[model samples]
Target: MNRHHHKPRLVNLLDDFAFGGVSRGLGIFSSQIVADAADCSVVAVRPDALIAPRLDADIIVVHFPPNWRRIAFLLSLRVRNPQARIMHVEHSYTRAWEALKVEQKGRFRLMLRIALRLVDQVVCVSCGQADWLREVAQLPWHKVDVIYPHAENPGLCTLPLPDFSCERPLVIGAYGRFHEQKGLENLIGAHRAGALPGTELVIGGFGPMEDELRQLAGNSPDIRFAGKIDDVAGFLRGCDLVAVPSRWEAYGQVACEAREAGRPILVAPVDGLPEQVGSAGLVIDFTNPDALARAFATLDNQRLGVMARAARRSAQDCGLDRQREWARLIRRLVPRQARPIGVPVTA
Candidate 1:
């Protein structure tokens, strides 16, 4: 079988699809792209993965365990599928992650550089991260594409602005992996110190830090964990304010989703969170418990409503244009001469 004679395929290779923003982003993008593409597939580079995206039945899934063997498998796939536009979205590394694993910096950089060289392009979710890859990882700027993934729940984007009449208790909601990077401890302490008075804190999602976070919350009846939420819209609608106190974020998808849900967000000023939030939401120093608490305690319903409107507008500004741009870039990677005519769904 001549690979060159076959239809061009867009393949997204991921190491894992653990419950995180990256996986969610990848799944959303994959779902959208498959409609505009001749054929689309996803490969999980980890063996016996707990969960993965429910892609089209016709899409091929190549599963392989992690390490050197996975690299060899990818290399072989590249050789066989010569016309396929293989793009590896780098979801595993960021400046914060590098800082955490400083010991493996040199080896990891070498590995990343080598692995990326095999693919048609490398996609980074944020511009800041794309810059990091070009500067620190020594990848050519041409090969690194910054395609911001839409974080909105498609079902919720059509909903109206949440009612911020201040009728109920000032509900402050935070969701995501309960990890150190999420700054859940600082949030918990702020709540415990009586900084966020007249408010009830709801923490949702699960992670390795679940036990530690529970311990941090202690017997505070004011703080509650909703665990993994399947109904994202219902969760965001219930909150008066959505807080994303990430110590570091490649791109804070939660903030984007909150905005689309018409809920104002309180976010940390780091990486892509600031870029995504823009002037639509409040920027807080998540490390300073006093400042965080004060910001929450003092915010009025009128101001909250204003921020919510701004957030929804911002989300509208950043939405489908990205999907169209991504389709254009993917088309460039696999020339029109190779792939069949498919509708650019964003149009």
Candidate 2:
């Protein structure tokens, strides 16, 4: 059996596939590079021990969050697939989120350590997240790799940046799940205080907090709720400014999409958001009620136009070269094909 003649089999194990960046990134991976590089498939699996049996592949990439109770499931996976290269993609869990949510710090840290040992490598979506793994989780730099989220929009570069040269109310757009983690309330708080006097704030998405958020808006003509937008580009195209006021984000997908459309983004200084802004937009204390208002107050037509152009340039610089990065990662992880286990079937 000549190993040089065979390509490695790669399986992406997804546990939580709700509406967010983790699920979206997997969608991109399926189409972008890995599928072309090797025999690749995306499979959804539960964290339960019974379902966590060794996946049939040369490489198994885990796209799931860690749990203390699932330590047995993880260990069993490694034990069963002793010959396979295992990797975990950390799409969530940052230093700020842990501080805000996890009360038992020591126990949580121990759980994370146990989980990390089960996999050969970690795929961090943002540089900031990798930094957190090193600074807070004490994970070695050698064990992790940073691959930023990227999307391919053909006409984004040609689309003109949002024009404020005409006399119209500033169209400020925010889109994502209406969850507390998203920090939509911070944006609403600013709009409610009459801080953004002439701006039209359009928020697109639905979640558990819909009714509550609607009530907070309270019969205001300027604030509108756009339920479940399928066209993210169309949404960004209509806006003068985009807001990503996440309390904790592994990487801001909307921030990336907004940049692709040449729209200036306003992101909170939390987790990977400031890293996403990267001089293309503004990074501020956007989560604070007072600061949120002041943040929007400083933005004018001239400043926004400058940022919009910068956003387009930033997106151009990033491009779709990440496809190559993914291919390289897979080839580096498993240099020689050990075996071909199974072909991917949709579940």
Best by lDDT: 2
Q: After superposition, how far is residue 74 of candidate 2 from its true place, in Å?
A: 1.1
Query: For residues 1-347, could you state the per-residue lDDT of candidate 1 as single tens digits?
Result: 33243334544556657655655655544546534743556656445333333332222223222234445655665665544455666654677657664586787777666666766667787887777777766888788888777654656676677677847777889998877888888788878888778879999999899999999899988999999988888887778778888777878788888888777888887666777766567788877878877777667878778888888888875666776776677557655543224422110
Write down the lDDT of every candidate, Cα atoms only: 0.69, 0.80
**Residue range 1-347, candidate 2, lDDT tens digits:** 43344577788888777766676666556664666777788887765644366566778888877887677777777777776789998887897899899999888888888888888999888888898887656688888999987655456666778887889898889999989988888788878887677889999999999999999999999999988977777777778889888899888888987887888898888888888786678886765667666776788788888889888888774655677788889899988664533434221
Q: After superposition, how far is residue 213 of candidate 1 from its true place, in Å?
A: 1.8
> Would you give me the overall lDDT of model 1?
0.69
How badly does each model clash, as a count of residue pairs? 0, 0
Report residue 59 deviation for candidate 2 (angstroms).
Answer: 0.9
Q: If scored against the real structure, what TM-score would every candidate get?
A: 0.80, 0.92
* RMSD (CA, Å), each prediction: 6.0, 3.2
